[model samples]
Target: MAKVTLPAAADTSAATVKVWDPVVRLFHWTIVTGVVLNLWVFEHGKYAHRLTGYVVVAALATRLVWGIVGTRHARFSDFFPTPRRVITHVYALWRGEDARQLGHSALGALMMLALMAVLTGLGLTGWMMGLDAFWGVKWVEDLHGLLANSVMALAILHVAAAVIESVRHGENLPWAMITGRKRALGAHDADIAD
Candidate 1:
């Protein structure tokens, strides 16, 4: 997770602090790469593509650990959204009035959960295909395809939301994830008072 600090205030200033950590940023991008590789593998039926799935599984495991032991902003607790909050936020979004959050928004949190589920399902199904009993099983193949499609759809939605939020907040959030240094909102470096 990104570090927070309180810098001395400049002349008449107010700012929000940075929130994303390098590991979080890395996990985000690596997942994207893994997803793309999986898609390519599916389309081309390449053995290498199957190998990349293992990489994604590993990355997800790493991310899960980081969520527990990582920086303040990177922890799952920092952005887990409640159902009520998601409903409220969805209503606000429909009405062109949404609340700002330092971390993932309510819907984003749901999407994260969905993505995790789909990925886990895919990994498990793929692993089963390697087992003797499940070898060359049609059902496993079909299930893998279904989960892969779902994951891809969710990923598109995630990117779209990130774009919209970036526009609304005037912050290049995706880029921030890459660099690990978010511009402080004001002269006062502050921690998210979550």
Candidate 2:
């Protein structure tokens, strides 16, 4: 393992660092609730369902804006999953290197971006389904269903990846999102400045 020092709040103690802000956590759980309610709990096209969808759309919009001007780790620039970054992450994993990241890993970042895009698709198609011209349009309805399914699938993968990475890095990642704290940076770990 290579020794590395990160630019962020790197510490040698066994303490946790704040990563996800409250806004980020709220957005995450709000989406989780909205997606669950819209997909499973509420009836399709009902007032509750549509209202939940709109809430989800609002949350997504808020997150998109927050990504531009949020806290250090909340900003997209911290982990945008560029092609080169993803490739390097994958290659390190292939070589059995420690690819643990202080913020989102490259693959995790890709998954987050993908899920957001699919959620946006769902929001757009859902809205179109309510419009005058697109009302009861088969294509819009189909696309909405497809996007919903994509989000569910991606969300499952995201959860599983978080669990696995948490185990690999000796920390509970899902809980970290809730508490907004993660273990301090260590050797062989990549922080935001990495």
Query: Each model's TM-score?
Result: 0.81, 0.89
> On residues 12-33, what C-alpha lDDT tens digit does candidate 1 reach at each position?
2234356777787877888899
Write down the TM-score for model 1: 0.81
Worst 10 residues of 2 by lDDT: 185-194
lDDT string for model 2 (141-173, tens) is: 999888888998999998898888878778899
The lDDT leader among the candidates is 2
For candidate 2, the TM-score is: 0.89
| lDDT of each candidate versus the true structure | 0.77, 0.85
Candidate 2 displacement at residue 134 in angstroms = 0.4
**Which runs in model 2 stand beyond 4 Å of their true positions?**
1-13, 192-194
